[model samples]
Target: MTQKTENTQSGYWFSKIPSKNWSEKFFLYWSLVWITVFSLIVATEAYKVFYDVEFFILGLFVSLPCVVIPYFFPCAADKDKPLWDRYWVKANVWIALFGFVGNYFWTHYFFVLLGATYKFPVDFRLNEVPVFLYFVTHAYFISYHSATTPILRRYWTAFGGKKSTLKTIGSVVIVFAMAYFTAFMEAWTMEKVPYYSIQDRERMYTIGSAFYMIYFIISFPMYARIDETGPQKNEKWSLSRTAIDSLASAMIVFCLCDFWRLIIGSIINPTNSIPFLGTHGIKA
Candidate 1:
C-alpha cells in the first residue's frame, strides 16, 4: 500500500511538470534547437561559402534590437499573459508567412521577368527568393521596425517632453534616416552581387533603395498604432486578431508596392516596371 501525500517526491515532480505550459515549453525547446543549429552552421565553411557577409550584417542589425529590447522591456502581453497575447511571437509567425508569400511573387518578377540573377552564396533560391534572405529582408526587418518604432517614439517624447514643430521635424528626419540606411544597405549588398545583365548598377542601387524606403514609410506609423503592447494588455489577445492585423498590413504593403510599379511604368520607363507583366508591351 502507498501513502497518498501531496508533498511526495513523485507528486512534486508531477506537479512541476504540469505547471509548465505548452507554449512556453514549445518555444523554449524550439529556440534551443534553432540556436544550436544556427550557431553550428555559422561555425562551418559551408556558411562562409554560401552566405554573404552583407546579409549577415543586415540580420545582425535587425535581430539585435528585437532580442535586446524585449529582454529589458518586454511587451506587456508577454508578462503573465497567455501565449496568444505575446505580440513578438505572433508578429514573427505572421511576418514569416507574409515574407514567404510575398517573396514568391515579387522574386519571380525580378528574377524571371526582369532578367536578374544573384551572386554565389546569396543565390540559394527558394520559391524565387533566397531562403535565409527571407529572414533578413522580411522577418527580422519587419519585427525590428515594429518593435523599435514605438521605443524610439517613447524615447523622443521622454527627451522632448512636449511636442514641438522642431521635435516633430527632427523625428521625421530620424525616421527617414533609418529608412534610407536600411535601403542603402540592402541595395549596397545587392550591388556587390550584381544582378546579371542588369547594367547601370547605380540605377539599380538608387531605385532599389528608394523603393525599399516605402516599406518603412508604410510600416513605421502603422506599427506605432497597432503594435503597442502596453495599451493592449487590457484587451483580449487571440491568434485570430493577430493574424487579421498582420494580413491587413501585408496586403497594404503589397498593394502599395504594386501601385508604385504601375505609376513608375506610366511615368518613368516601362522597362523598369515591377510586378512582372504589369507593364504593357513587356515580355517575360
Candidate 2:
C-alpha cells in the first residue's frame, strides 16, 4: 500500500497509501482515450506542421496494432480480480519495448543515409539516439491497444472461425490505411512546423511505414494468440504482462521506453540528439 503524510501546520501534498487497486486505475477505457485518441490527434497535427509525409507513414503502421489489437485480445481482469496481476505488467512492458527497440534498427540506418554535413549536423552516434527514442516512444500505441483489447473481447468473440479471420485481416488493412492517411496529414504538417529537414527523410518515412506493415502482418498471429488466452485473473504471472493491458499498460510502457532510452542515452547520446526524445523529451 502507498503511504501518504501531512503536516498539520504547513499544507503540503504528500504520499498516498495504495488503494487496493488505485495503482492500476490507468488500465481502463478512460486511460485509453486519454493516451491513444488524443495522441493520435496531436501526433497527427504535429506531424502535419512538422514533418508531413513522414508522419503519415508513421501513423499508418501505428494504426494496425492500435485498431486490430485491442478488438481481438481481451484483458484478464474484472471486478472479481480487482488488482492488476503480473502478466498485465509484463505484457505492457514487452509491447512498448517491441516498438521502441524495433524502430532503433531503422532509425539508425536512416541517419547513416542522411548526410551529417547538413545544417542539422548529425553525429552518427548522437543523431541515432532520436531514431531509437522514436521507436521507444511510439511503442505506447501498441500498449494502448493491449489494454483496450480486453474490453472488446466480447465483441470479437461474436465473430468466430472464418468470420473472425476475415474481420482481423480487414481490420489490419483499415488500420494500416487510416494510419497512413494520418501520416500523410502529418507530412503536410511538416511543411508548416519544419521540425526536420533534409533531402530524403520523406523516403525514410515511407520505408519505416513499410517496415511497420510487414511487421504487423507477421505479428498478427501472436496477437491473436494473446486474444485466445483472454483474461486470466488467477494467473499470477498476468499483471507483469504489460503487453496485455492496452491503455494503462501502454502509458506505463511509454514511460519505460523513455527510461530505457535515458539509460542508454546516458552512455551513448548524452547530447540529447535523439530529436523527439532528446535530453528534454517532448520539449525541444
Candidate 3:
C-alpha cells in the first residue's frame, strides 16, 4: 500500500506515476539533481573551474522556472490554435525574471559553499559572468522549450500514444534530444566566447552529459503534462495554445538560428568576428 501510494503518480514518460496532483514535482527533482551534479563536477575540477557563491542560489530562482514553470503555470489555452500565439515575448520576460532571481540565489549559494570566492585565471566577476550567464541561460531555455512543446505534443499523440507507458519512454527521448541539441549548439557557439566552458565535465559523463540526460528524462512530463490532460473536442490550436506553441517554437528556432549565425560570423570574419550580438537577442 505504501509503495503503491507513492507509485500512484509515478509514470514512465511524464508522471512516472498516476499522480494527478504534484505531477510536475518529478521534473523539479530531476532538474535539481542535474544542476547539483553539474555544479559539483564543475566545482571539483578546480584546476579548470572556479565556483561562484553568488550565482549558486541565484540559479535556483531563475533556473527553477525554465526547468519547471511551464509545468506548473503553463499557458492556459482553448482548442483552436497554438498555445504560444502572440504572447511569446511576454513569456520570455517571465523566464528572464526567474533567471534574475535564480542567478541571484544560486551564485550566492555556490560561491560560498564551493569557494568560488577566489578568482581564477579569468578573474570571475559576478556582474559579468554569474549574473550574465543566468540571464542568457534563461533566455536560451525560453527559446528551446517554447519551440519543442508543439512538436513533442504532436509527435507523442501522433504515435498512438495514450497516457501510459508508451508516453513515459517517448517523453524522455523527446526532451532529452531537444536539450542535448541545444547544449550542442551552445557549446559550439562557445568556441569564441567560451564563457560557459566545461572542459572538466567531459570526463564525468555521469555528472555532466549523463546527468543532464537524466534531468531531461525525469522531467519529461512537465512540458507535456497539460497536453496529456486531453485537448478540446477540436484539435486546432487555440489562441492560448497557438501562442504557447508558436512562441516556444519560435524561441527555439531563434536560438538555433543565432547559433548558426555565430558559426557564419566565425567563418566570414576570421580575424575579429562576433555572432548575432547586435542583430538580435537569443532569449526564448
Q: List the residue pairs that clash in candidate 1.
A: none
Model 1 Cα lDDT, one tens digit per residue, 1-284: 34433233222211111211222233343444444544465455334444556556545544444444444555444567555566555555555555665566555444433334444456445654555566655534553454445445554544423557876787777777777777676556444332333434565566656656666655555554333333542244456766776667667867776776666632224466444552223221
The reply for model 1, stretches above 4 Å from the true place, is 1-48, 51-80, 112-116, 119-126, 155-174, 190-198, 226-237, 266-275, 278-284
lDDT of 2: 0.38
| TM-score, one value per model | 0.57, 0.40, 0.39
Best by lDDT: 1
| Candidate 3 displacement at residue 248 in angstroms | 20
lDDT scores of the candidates, listed in order: 0.50, 0.38, 0.41
Ranking by TM-score: 1, 2, 3
Question: Ranking under lDDT, best-scoring first?
Answer: 1, 3, 2
RMSD for all candidates, in order, please.
12.7, 16.4, 18.2
Off by over 4 Å in 3: 1-90, 105-130, 159-161, 194-201, 204-207, 212-221, 224-284
lDDT of 3 by residue, 121-165 (tens): 333445334343664466455545445554565556554434777
